[model samples]
Target chain A: MDVRVDRDRCIGAGMCALTAPEIFDQDEDEGLVVLLNTRPPQERRAAVRIAAGACPAAVITLTEQDTSTAP
Target chain B: MQHEPSLTEPVTLPTQRAAGCPFDPPAGLAELREQRPLTRMTYPDGHVGWLATGYPAVRAILGDPRFSSRYELLHYPFPGGPEGPLPPAPVGDMTGMDAPEHTRYRRLLMGKFTVRRMRQLTDRVEEITAEHLDALEHRGPGADLVKAFARPIPALVICELLGVPYADRDRFQGHADTIMSMDAPPEEGYAAMAALQEYMAHLVAAKRADPSDDLLGDLACDSDLTDEELIGIGAFLLAAGLDTTANMIAHGTFALLTNPAQAEALRTDPDLAPRAVEELMRYLTVAPTTVRSALEDVEVEGQMIKAGESVTISLEAANRDRERFPDPDVLDLHRKATGHLGFGHGIHQCLGQQLARVELMVALPALLGRFPTLRLDVPADEVPLRTNMNIYGVHRLPVTWDED
Candidate 1:
């Protein structure tokens, strides 16, 4: 899964960091989204999805690969 | 010919909940959500606008930039609210302002309240909670939890965070009570607000002269926020942080006392505290409603919101929406209540949420653990509710515990 965050849109509610700490963190200076990992492992998918959905500003975006086609 | 009810006919916002159902949102709100998530509504000012009742609709309106939070653009939803268009939000009062201005203040404040920073405050929160519990135990057998326990924990924490002396808590708390009370006359509310602002101004000046290790002190020293803005922000934070969490703690305790099984579930399993906090927040959404005005003509949920039309988003109703939360009325601690609108949504979401969460996570379990035999002193139905205020909570949660 590819992960992304829009710092411009991020209001720093920290929902992403709290929900998916492995994949996201808030920048110390401004409390904006800081993408910690661009591609998290498959095991972290559910958490990443939850984080994306939970973001009040809709700052987090995830691109999930179709597992059905994968070996 | 029978006169058919028009879609534009405004429905007054419901204030009365089902009798004896203290935890529920106002009666008719859920039915309104079921019928139409967004509907024409009449404000207390007699301004016809829209009310968003469903989870999805309220969320959409809050997240959409086209919906303005500007105070001047919106109509008051409650009676005795300021007549005519209100003045623009004061400097640093981000709740009533739109972007750019709101953005700048929010950014400056956000770093102070990041998830990590709040987590770091957990130990402190635990200490504060324990201290309050100690006091409550000393004063009880029977006491008003709202006064002795609920109000003090958050007040002291917020004071410590902002570098305000806890010695001044009674003064500020009195001011906050007056300003937030719907029953207070307009002049009294204004006077209370002015006095609080004056107090904050003095504090801000002190911070500027000698920087301290706290939220306001840091901002005063490090940021370009003017004294006026700092004062506004300080006063705003004090008012914001105090009553909301205090109510949640008091009302949440009230909730647990009434629901013995749920209370037992949490009391036995300390690990359930985190989830219990979220569930309680969802179940008893204290800051019940927020308002937004349309910045421009926009389509929302098949309705066209014309420019400047105000919409009141019922956070309480939204959190209880059956489509979003299954068995919405239940107080189950184990439920996944993450996406609830308890702290609100969008750009102006509560900045102090993480801190509030930390406080609740520490305070609730600690209170229960400290007083395992805690129960309501007054009958559940007899407890006075804060129905008149914009924030929903119990006025005085009279509680008792078994004395050693």
Candidate 2:
């Protein structure tokens, strides 16, 4: 899985970071999204997807690769 | 020559919620959203600007920073539009300020309000809710829920978080109420503000002298925020935290009592409190309308809003648009209430939202659990509504419960 966050657009409500801290963290000084893991193992992908979906600003996006989506 | 548009019509803001349906948005808003998604609105000051009831338009406007939140720059939407561009929001009041400035204060405070930190307070919230519920139960079969339960939880929680002495809460809440009141006497309100300022100034100084682990203390220890900024931030949090949540609890209880089926649903399944809270927030948008001014020429949904022109995004209206949420009028506890703008949205979304959510999540379930047969002491019509205030809610929720 791959993830991206728009720092400029992030108002830093902190929902993303709080939900999936492994994948996302915030700049304490700026309260902006710090995309920690651009790509993560399959185990973390599901949680990251939930985090992305839950973001209030819709700043987080994830793309799943073929192997990642493999059943 | 401009062609005449037959479909579009003028509409003024702040139409009244239909009688006996205090939980729903104005009936006219539903009609307006259908007839004219966007309309030419004339403010009381006679400044003609756009008024939006459509969901998409409101989302675009609130999410875009170009639509400045600077209160002074925008044409005020309420009764009397204050003449002249207002002064910038006070040093620490980040709500009315734009980015960079807003970024500074919001960033400093973000450390305190993180979702994890807020969730950690769930146990504390439960304790507080239990304490209030115990007192309410002990009082009698009939009592004012607002004074007995709704008002105390948020007030105490905020005071504890900000390190403001809880002993001073009554004085502090009084001043905060004055500042929030739309119809209060100007001189009286000004005096309350001054008193609150003086009170906060002393508290800030004490924190500076001896900082602690609380939010205000943490800031006082690390940051170089001046006393005024600290006071302003404290005051801002106090006003925001106290009013919105208090009303939600008070009015939310009223809403549930009137709709017993919904209350029973919550009582039977306590887990439903979270979604029920969201539905209540959407159904009763306490912070009715927010104003924004275009910083540059922007085309939104085919309408060109020129720079300096302002628009009012009626959240009450937007949240109820049937296109977005089917049968938006109905309060469904099990409904997927995510993405609702109960806490508003975008960069300027509510800061203390997680805390607010946790409090409501804990308070509502506990209240219902403690008093299964809870109900309104007064008739629905006699239950006073806060129509005059900027925040829509009840003046008092008179409630009763089975003594046995």
Best by DockQ: 1
lDDT of 2 at B88: 63
**How many steric clashes does model 2 contain?**
0
Quote the true-contact fraction of every model.
0.77, 0.38
Write one digit per residue (lDDT tens) for candidate 1, span A1-71.
78888898789999988888988898888899899888787778889999999899998877786555322
Instruction: Quote the lDDT for B360 in model 1.
Output: 89
For candidate 2, the docking band is acceptable
Which digits, one per residue and each the tens of the lDDT, describe model 1 over residues B1-404?
Answer: 99977756789988888999999999999888888889999888878899999998899999999999998888878788887566677777799988888998998889889999899988988888888788777776888888888888998899998889989877688898888888887778879988999988888889999999998889988999889999999999999988889999989999999999998998899899889998999999999998999989999888999998999999999998899999999999999999999999999989999988998888888888899999888779999999888678988988888888
Candidate 1 CAPRI grade: high
The global C-alpha lDDT for each of the candidates, from Candidate 1 onward, is 0.89, 0.81
The 10-residue segment with the lowest total lDDT in model 2 chain B: B79-88
Tens-digit lDDT string for candidate 2 (B81-101): 356454567667898988888
